[model samples]
Target: MTAPDLEQRADHIVEQIDRFVADGKRVVLSSSFQTQSLPLLHLVSRSRGVTVYFLDTGYHFPETLEFRDQVTEQLGLDVVSLHSATTKAAQVGPHGHLLFAEDPDYCCYLNKTAPMETVAAASDIWISGVRRDQSETRRQLDEFVVRSDGTTRYHPMLDWTEPMIADYQERHDLPRHPLDDRGYVSIGCAPCTRNIPGSDRGGRWFGMEKTECGLHVDLVR
Candidate 1:
């Protein structure tokens, strides 16, 4: 689809969100403070009724945490910092050894899936920034979907492309993620993500046949 078509769909989704709030719905934006993720955060922050939540995975790059604080204060966001239920004793040291190599999915569950599930328990509408052009897995996603886990999901930017995102960021004078210019178009936990050159590998967890961090995939099934 063209950029205009994508923008129209995004506007439509935002309008629906506005209406949902007017009708007393509990709306939340599950943001990661990614460069592209900021636009939706800004959108939700404009309304007092829409809440924003993010997981503070212990493994996040220091820069991500800094940016999260900066954006939250700048936008006057009532952001909830979701934490992993597993204690430091269970996650670290020699005994557990989760996500050292083949157990990336397990690690994702603790850091991404679980924390989000906890925060979303009380929310009816959960907004996401997933876009179609980001990956083949994302291409199959619709603008609005109901997950198996029960939270209503909205992907306002589902059909948007990288160029479209760049334009929007530039127009709004938005800050880019620190890693965006360093060959990493998608950013997640520092260890699970890497730099990809050219127009390839748009998804995080690339080169491993894993397109998601267990958050989206767990919901699909």
Candidate 2:
């Protein structure tokens, strides 16, 4: 897509967001604060009163936290941190191992999906920066998804690719996550994240069959 196409697409998304707000819909955005997430963050920043929710899973890299803080300050966003109702110490399995080691699904449920379900249940629209080309699962996603609970999941960045993100970042001079320079293209919890060459989501969940952290799958269910 050319510069004009990108600008038009962005304007369309902003128009929809503004329409939602005009209708008195409660719009909320969930961000992971990764480098790729900057485009959507910048897009949403065009509107006012949209609170950005970050799920602080208690297992994030310190650099991810710092990036989140830096982005929040830079964007002048209304950012809110959500945590699991269960304490980190309480997230253990039968063998006294951390739930992420024995049962990643359960760990994700406790840390991310549950907290986000609450936000989705209460909000009229939930915006996320999930791109289609990033992973197979996300490739099946649509621009707007109305969940079972009646909340709309909007993915304005769904059609955007890595090159588009890079161009936008360069154009806007957005800051990148510190780990991005080290090859952590798709940032998540430190334990399940690694540096995998040539694939956006290859490092996530490392060797596990699971790709998503359940916010995209289970939260809507």
* Number of the top TM-score candidate: 2
Q: Provide the global lDDT of candidate 1 against the true structure.
A: 0.74
The stretch of ten residues in a row with the least summed lDDT in candidate 2 is 212-221
The TM-score that candidate 2 achieves is 0.96
Clashes of 2: 0
Instruction: Write model 1 residue lDDT over 71-156, tens digit each, in one string.
Output: 98888988888888987457653455656355677777877788888767767888888877776777777767776567788777
Q: Poorest 10 consecutive residues of model 1 by lDDT?
A: 93-102
Residues 142-175 of candidate 2: C-alpha lDDT, one tens digit per residue = 8888887899998888888889888888888999
lDDT, candidate 2, at 92: 92
- How does each model score on lDDT? 0.74, 0.88
TM-score per candidate, chains pooled: 0.86, 0.96
Total residue pair clashes for candidate 1: 0
